[model samples]
Target: MTVVTPVAARVTEGRSLTWRVSLSEAADADMSTMFVVVPATAPGLSTKDVPARWPRDTAGAKPDPERPLSKVDGLYLFVDVPAGRTSADVTLPTLGDRVAEPAEPVRFRQTDMDTGEPLPDGLVLSGSVLDAS
Candidate 1:
């Protein structure tokens, strides 16, 4: 099981996150896991590494208040599933390692976060859609 930072009623963009991720087996079937700090926030990096710095207004329209203004920076891990690429289990410390809010699932057929293009072959993971929270 994963402990995700529950999405807030009004989570703002540019907010920072802390997180850690591992396999369910690593938890020994128990979800009481501790958090490892996110590496991107550590020293020796330039401003380019910041997630909050990702462009938000490039679409020529104000961002939907519910959408992320930048690439969300959070703690995450990839778990090996059978015969496929790793699936990301993201952990957000800003919200206590809870998953994105609204807890809604989305398919990649939805609009792209970047150019608003229809995501080709879209999101295959639970995180593809974020909650309205």
Candidate 2:
């Protein structure tokens, strides 16, 4: 059961947010990769905005513009985790200027790379609310 907790419950627009990923237990040998999902409706957010430390998985990282909004619920940002690490830090890219005040809380959850399913225990207890100044 892995859990991802945002360092801050809220962040100013145009700023980056950091999240802490804690493994309930030591990372499994087969658990080599993970991903975070952000709402597609998030303004100016994209897979290309992810930090370099967490390289995007070319295979599934690309979002289809033609996909229906109903079907496209969120965007995927992939990350590689070294084995046995108990925890890791993920810093999201800066919010774009287009972000509006009182923007929706940016929720995040860790998911399985292959399954594209949220980890059994990787639900986001709280999302980082965006404040436009």
Candidate 3:
């Protein structure tokens, strides 16, 4: 199982997330091939929007990486936010299907990228979705 630890929330263009991800259950799984579930409305804030100073090799820094963003069924985004380097622009693209009324505040679910299934444990991170529009 994978656990998500949301560190902080900030607003740049939209909701930005600084979180730590790890595997709670050790398995022959690829960390790179994982997905984080996010609100469908915030795809723009993925790794594509982080500033240069972000994710520096500092003491508090997590192993963050620039990941590709894609929509899943239009209700949520299967985001590829890597673990460790702890910073990401949590904005999502407004494409495809959408929830009529998304629940608040924001939340994340760790899942297998290949199977699109949850990590088979209580791996969740729930927090506010700061909107700096």
- Judging by TM-score against the true structure, name the best candidate: 2
What tens-digit string does per-residue lDDT give for candidate 3 at 6-54? 5653322344445555455443433453335555344333333333333
Per-residue lDDT of model 1, residues 1-133, tens digit only: 3223223312232343322233333432323221211222212111222232222222232323334323222222222222222222432212222334432221112233444443344322222222223
- Quick one: ranking by TM-score, best first? 2, 3, 1
Models 1 onward score TM values of 0.19, 0.56, 0.38
The sequence of per-residue lDDT tens digits that candidate 2 reaches over residues 81-103 is 45777777665554444534554
Single out the weakest 10-residue window by summed lDDT for candidate 1. Answer: 36-45
Model 1, residue 23: C-alpha shift (Å):
22
Q: How accurate is candidate 2 locally (lDDT)?
A: 0.51
Q: Using lDDT as the measure, which candidate wins?
A: 2
TM-score of 3: 0.38
- Misplaced by over 4 Å in model 3 are 1-3, 9-15, 22-30, 36-103, 131-133
